[model samples]
Target chain A: MRRAGVLALVVTTLAVAAALDTPAASAAASRLAWLVPVALGAVTLGTRPGALVALLAVSFRAPDILAGVERDGLTAVTFDAAGDAVVLLAAAVMTGSLAAAARLQRRRYEALGAVQRVLAIEAPLERTLRRVIACLDWRLGCAALTLTLRDGDAVATASAGCSALAASGNRDPVTREVLRSGRIVYLADAGGQPRPRRVLGAPLTAAGVTIGALVAERTGELSPPERETLVMLAAHVGLGLENARLAAMNRRAASELDTKIAAATHRLAEADRAKSAIVALASHELRTPLAALLGFSELLATLDFARDEVRRLAGIVRRETARLARLVDDVLDLSRIERGLPVPLGPRRVAVAAALEAAVEIFAGVDADGTGRRFAIECEAALPRVVADPDALDRIVKNLIANAVKYSPPGSPVGITARAVEGAVEVTVADAGRGIAPEARARVFEPYYRAPDVVRGVPGTGLGLAVVKALVEAHGGTITLDSAPGAGTRVTFRLPIAREASSAAPVD
Target chain B: MLAALGALAGAAAVLGGHGLLPPRAAALIAVAAMNAAFIATALAWAGAPGAGAVAAGLVLAASGAAAGHPAGAIAYLALPAWLASLARGGRLVGLGLGARPPAPALLAGAALGVGLIAHLALTVSRTRGYGFALGPPSVVLSSLAYDVGVNVPCAECFLRGALFNRAQRRWSLHGAMALAVALGLARYLADPLLPHASEVLAGAVFYVALLGMGNCWLFWRWGSLVPGTLSGILLFEGYRLLVVS
Candidate 1:
């Protein structure tokens, strides 16, 4: 609006000045006098207006000045006319310069606005690239853009206006120059069969490393200034491209890692199945030998009364062999349970208190001399009968009680408790001794895994807890440990009470 | 005494700002000294050296206002120094005496100086329209001189020192430089096409928005926004001032 007003005022003032300076009014330059007032009016309006008025005034005086020179034969009037021309030219240049400056400023603000939009919203990488490309294209008057980036040796990737352009690979020279010199490259034209008329290439370098080249293509030619501008634009474009690429690479890596972890998990599950099978086979194979060893040891014990000294030696051998047979039996049982092999179990409705007493009776004769451990059973009188495999149940209870007695400190009491809990029998065997560490607690139930805090040289097989855990679970029960280092250890197992006698029996 | 001290500080600030002294250290010291003087002599009236402080303040405010364009206003502020020589009864005459040869010469000289500065700024602004536009011939030359002779190298030092900071994290000098270059380029490409006061103002607002948005993305994905943001600010402003000023 200001420009328009100024231009209007200039044109009007010049028109008025030309009228006053017309040849007819020259003789009456003093008489015509209205031109001065008009000129003053134009100045008040604005410079453009004043200049316009002056221009008109001079144009009007031009003919008179020319006529006077012709008639009077003097160059003074012609010189005066030329002076007016010079003033008008000066005014025109000033207006033109201001207009150009205004245009430049407007461009700058528009660019800022575009950048603002880029920053204001969350956009995908592709969208950002497009926006950046559009911004550069709009400002530089370039038709197409190509950003070629080096990965290791060759161009890692190239973003181009047309995929076909990328296919042609005209950007190699620019890329090579940037890669070699690590400097911006400007080309007036790509001198090839299918060359772009004007090309501006700048190295997209970060940390003094020339990572890529940004090339802007134009149809005609670029001025030196325009070329320089393109190089700068390319540099910025390179940055945007690098950001996008890095984001993409990171995303790709994350996805790849996720897939790898999934594959690893599947392989681990397969390995677990294999281990279970191995344990089952080993246990089944050892059962026969274990039974034979037990029979021989019992037979030898009976024939041990020939002589006092010989008898005592035979008793020692018999005890050691019996212990070895028991160890083998425990391993076979643990392996069978782990592999889900059917065991000969008879289910019957039995009183929970009777079962606890029976397990205690079986362990009463065990050597607890060194430990001085005593066993006690505390069963609620009102505890309901639980239907289970009596032999398996007895073995589970006996194993827990024996372990407690064997491992507890001397003079400590091994407590056995049985109670009715939510339609189930809850039994716990607790021992006062060195406790299991938090790290080893989970592994203690696994075959051959013993708590490190247990004395290194102990008598029992480490499969005790493994067999206990399996037998408990087979009866639709759960076993867990409540123990910490130095606080002693308590192992608890819960078995569901059978609703009917038939429910306790396993189906074929 | 405080008032006198403040006057000295004020003088130092002017010298620092005007490049008569090294800008970085001088700027820091001058700022501290002037602020202290302002507080210490807070109750002092405008008399004796106090007047000089007031004058210095006015100059500073004017120069700061014209920071991006360091011509018109800065030169106008300096013009009075030459006029002081022609003082008559503590006031200089204009029209008759002002139009005298000597006075015109002084005014012409001042105008030329201002015009030259404005021209230089415009040229720089044109050349440096994008991140650190310091890559341009003009900037590279000036930076070289500064690094070799003045040895201040504030920007370079900042970049190098900042690498050691854990809080500054994302340790890519290349990425920083790239961001700088992008913003600078954006400004340059933007300015000529949208050349207008309203447009320039709008552009500035938009540029800031871009920086903020880009930084936010960096922060969200990488958990660090400072590097991207710092580079953007430095490059954008540097480009605007140097190439497009």
Candidate 2:
């Protein structure tokens, strides 16, 4: 309404100016004050309005032309009026075209700005796509807008201001063309079922890859600015889609990181709990023997006892001190292995039979006081030598024999067996004693873990089996425990046979 | 007492100087407030700084907000509360800055319902037109940024963080809530356009009071400023779109 009022006012001013200038204007100078309305109309409105103004300006000169014809002649007035009309018309057309182009440029600027706004919203891909379609439809004044994205072999379509594209049954030719050419395609009179009068399609490309196409449909042919707007919208849609994909990937990565962190936290907590339990148990174990040793030695020192009594008290102290010493040595050895400190091993050919016999002699001497425990030795002829540290070999044999004698019934025969099996030497120490329960077997190798039933009345640190397993693995050998309750126990191990040197004789 | 006085002085300075200062100076003040609050919060959390020092930091932050950075005001206000909670061996939730899941869910639903209803009323009254005109993208983006960053955070800080939390500490919960409602209404009353006639005054008071009380209740029930802030933002944005344009 305001625009119409302004146009009317301009026309009235032009009419008044033309009437005032017509009479005073010389024949040489054509009265062209009428061109003002034409130029103004063309710049403010479009070509049609500007043309109407030019016609009005030419008609307003009719009265002047008639007066001129009465006073002068027909040829001069006709030429003057005709010349002014032509100039006005030409100016109107030129200015109108420039105005139309400027308007389109302004619209294009607005369209780009709107696309930027749509992209700024950090929404999911589907939501962002829907918003982008809405934005394009509103900004371009289109009847309908659609976004079709390529999903592998299939196309996923989303639309605004219209029903969805006829599902998979109907293919859109414009969309297909845009996707194929990777360029903008405009369709005039898009003639298909559910056809639009006009359609503009632009390819949505991201990082140099043609991902999809954006299509806008309208009831009339799109202006050049509208088509350019569609192109800009498509570019931003491609960028928005990439951003959405990156956000989803980041979310997935964060979720995985959270899971891993939770798992690590749980493991650390469990380890801490186990360490605390071990510390508590170790303190109790150490204090009990130390208490006994101190009490007995104090009693032997302060009290004047009879000869026999003194001997008994002194013996008790000796046993407790030995137990304490053994506990300390076991702890030190386990710590060394755990810390990855090398244990001194003198690798040499050691006769297994000689080590076993010596171990048996030591066992017999310890039990010589009274408790009758018998040992039976069995060895295959030409038994092979083993490559081992001699002292370690001696300790291994002694520990096994001691365990066998301790667990067996009085007078039970503990067997020591050695046999050559393929390239390895096998040794077994069997005792007619209580065997380990199945449930406790797997965990027996864990440090400080003791079987409740086995530890009752047994004065042995639970570190023995744990240390044995570590030592065997250190030598690249393996050990196995075969036992059942009331059926006795058998411990077997295999060590690779020592390779003979070319210049050295085999030890028998 | 000194911390409270400092806070009051800072708030007065910001409110007084807001319209008087040039845009560039206001912006600088806002940035300085944000940085001061951030640094103070970090130090308090990492090294257990004294309460006096934390309070002083918050005072500086409040002055910054007064200088026209509403978002910075929220951070500055929140830092002091967080520091106080830490000194007391309490949690942020205890001071109404964090929410449990169920509370937030319930509050969100309530906020949405209220916002929608208010928006519809405003639209029917023709207070403003629907705001979704095809405008320059820059204007739209800037408006949204102002909504989320400046308006929402600043309002939440004033009502929930500084006003409600401080009142609750000094008085009973109900008393603190009454004070918050009064303050909220006082803000609306301060607007020059509000009808001064008695008949219009009652209705205006009732409307502003209800909004204020509802927001305060949301803060208290959820044990956080988040729900209340979100509710305020949703309602404000909805109103802007449907009515004020």
What are the models' TM-scores?
A: 0.35, 0.39
| DockQ of prediction 2 | 0.00
Model 1 agreement with the true structure over A1-508: per-residue lDDT tens digits:
6566566555655555566544465434522343453344343443344454444444344444444554566576656555655655465446544554455556555655565455344465556655666665566566567666676665654344542233456535665676688787665444321222455668876556777777776654354545555555555555655666676678889999999999999867855764565465446535544565566566666665456765656555555565556556676786677677965557777676887887676556544365445778888878776767887887788788878777767778889998889989899999987778899988888776655556344544467888888888877789999888778889999988766555644421
Question: Top TM-score: which candidate number?
Answer: 2
Give the least accurate 10-residue stretch of model 2 chain B, judged by summed lDDT.
B123-132
Interface RMSD of the candidates, in order: 26.6, 31.4
Off by over 4 Å in 1: A1-326, A336-347, A368-372, A455-461, A501-508, B1-245
Which window of ten consecutive residues has the lowest lDDT sum in model 1 chain A? A188-197
True lDDT of residue A504, candidate 1: 48
Range of the 10 consecutive residues with the lowest summed lDDT in candidate 2 chain A: A188-197
